[model samples]
Target: MDSWPHPQPLTNRLELVAVPRPVLTALVSGRAAAALPPPLVTPYLAGEECAGLWRMRSMQLSDKPGDAPWVTRFVVVPGVSGAVGAAGFHGAPDQVGMVEVGYRIAPEHRRNGYARQALEILLSVAGSSPDVRVVRASISPENHASRALIQQFAFAEVGEQWDDEDGLETLFEMVLRTQ
Candidate 1:
């Protein structure tokens, strides 16, 4: 358990909880089903996959240098109960000043404007850092909903990349206004 509290502040119907390695490990090992977080409803989008991704990100950050939070947070809706999904940065801003942001909301939580609000959290957090100048997001071309969510921001289609699972994905980039 982590003593430090670094939750993302939001002004909506949700809150962000830091998902530590232990919790993630349990989730992946199927132990969370018995003792999951109170706010997390049963069958939490099968977080096992996201936990695997989190482990990979953690390994990369540990093997490299610089400041990377390497933290995955759960989207908790207090009164409604249960975590909708997860969101966090890929890593700290690179030397070239680019940071990648990723997020996913459960199918049940979609169409409720949670994604847009969640994105506001990402943008605000990255913008608060002095070293971060640009935020990147890559989405599958067939994911019209995600594209629409990103369109709410000032992001532009910069390029594309091939993914093993998602195939060719369209990349969007946004330059943050740093003072």
Candidate 2:
């Protein structure tokens, strides 16, 4: 029932915020997609498939009340000197009080630690929320960069899952209780 807030600039290096449908449409249909890899194209093109993702992001920025429980998405736009990045929660903060996080850096933005920076921000935000007790990340077994980024957060290898839509992925979970 709580309304979400508008996008706010963070650390002068990124903006943790939600994006509207029109802007999402533009990003997917415009040159933005051109800067992403093949794996990100389908979700950008098929809004239906990404409806939950979009709604989560919307709710994060919405002022409307009585919104259902959902995950939040953030567009990681780097500061004046950096390129755009993308990241989001996988679903509503879970019943077990865990949330999953995912992210991608534009091909041009890789190797600059943006993914790690974004993950830290997300984890901090989620951890600060009373409803969130843990944060999880599922990455493809072969994605070394993703695995490495998550390791920096000290997320332990909990298990693996056979994603019907994504083949096999390794699931890592991290406790986010107050330090």
Q: Highest TM-score among the candidates is held by which one?
A: 1
lDDT of 1 at 162: 98
Regions more than 4 Å wrong, model 2: 1-12, 25-74, 77-83
162: Cα error in model 2, Å? 1.3
TM-score of each: 0.82, 0.66
**Could you give candidate 2's per-residue lDDT for residues 1-179 as a string of tens digits?**
12223223344355445444455444445444454333333333333445444544555545432222334434444332332455657655666888888786656567976677677767766766888888989999999999988887769999999986668999999887743
lDDT of all predictions: 0.70, 0.60
Residue 20 local lDDT, model 1: 59
Cα error, residue 175 of model 1, in Å, equals 0.5
Evaluate residue 76 in candidate 2 and report its C-alpha lDDT on the 0 to 100 scale.
Answer: 47
Clashing pairs in 1: 39-82
